[model samples]
Target: MNARVLVAYGTKNGSTAEIADVIADALKEAGLRSETRPAAAARDVTEYDAVVLGGALYAGRWHRDAVRFARRHEHSLAERPVWLFSSGPLDASAGERDIPPVPSAARAATLLDAREHVTFGGRLEEGARGFIARMIVKQGRGGDFRDMERIRAWARGIAKEISKAGPASPT
Candidate 1:
């Protein structure tokens, strides 16, 4: 038996979803049972022993669906080990100019007693850009900044924590 971990994410251009997939894969490799789904598909967190929620940041705000999911599962999440992540901000610099997760999302993370909230680099694809995004890209402010090694390291850390707890009875 292994702890079941849910890795749910909300994405605008599919970047966050791919990040979630890699996380789930890492969890599985570490001997935890993990599932990755869009936030909309994850209506409840009670069934999983732990949770990893992620979303794409938009104008310093987390994707709406991820925020909604956090609200909807507030109680269940509060009782479980939870981690939060957001992917956005094309700036390679990790310090200033990094777009943060919005206030409401931060509040939700606090309420859930999230183990950690990590903000990762993001990518803006030309093919997926909309009017405003295209304009921003045209201004030369677009590039892939996602650091896969950082993402994998974070997932490994989560897996290590889950493993330390040993197997959990699935709900």
Candidate 2:
């Protein structure tokens, strides 16, 4: 039986999309079959054995499409093993202290019985933003804050959990 994982993400400047791809690569290295796609592009959750949903956090909240995807597919996701992640907070100096308050995505994920939720640092590029986004980026922030080692470790952990859960049942 093959383990199929769906990595769905919402990106603004494409940072989250890159993160999703990296996660899918890690899952593949862990011996699991995974596909990465935009949240809006994914049509059905029932086809996958496992789901990994990620979003770019703006003002401490996940993208709207991601939230809707979880809410719309809550029933199907609840029955299958799920994981959630958010990308934001470029201030590495804050460490764990920079963790945002309970994001709506996390709350919804909990209600849907997600196995794990994580907050990964995000990136912002210079000149790749509107006035406000650029202002936020100019505060000596706006760099690739993604921790690949941590990301790979988390993927490995998820792979282990999925391996233990075996394959999903055909409906």
Which predicted model would earn the best lDDT? 1
Please name the candidate that would achieve the greatest TM-score relative to the true structure: 2
Q: Which clashing pairs does model 2 show?
A: none
70-162, model 1: which lDDT tens digit per residue? Answer: 988987887778999998878875334444457866886888889888888888868665687777678888888888878888999999987
Runs with alpha carbons beyond 4 Å of true place in candidate 1: 95-100, 167-171
What is the C-alpha local distance difference test score of each model?
Answer: 0.84, 0.82
Report the poorest 10 consecutive residues by lDDT, candidate 1.
93-102
Q: Tell me each candidate's RMSD, in Å, in order.
A: 2.4, 2.0
lDDT of 2 by residue, 46-130 (tens): 8889999988888777887788888888888887898988887776732354454246876767877888788888888887556
- How does candidate 2 score on lDDT? 0.82
In candidate 2, stretches whose alpha carbon ends up further than 4 angstroms from where it belongs are 93-101
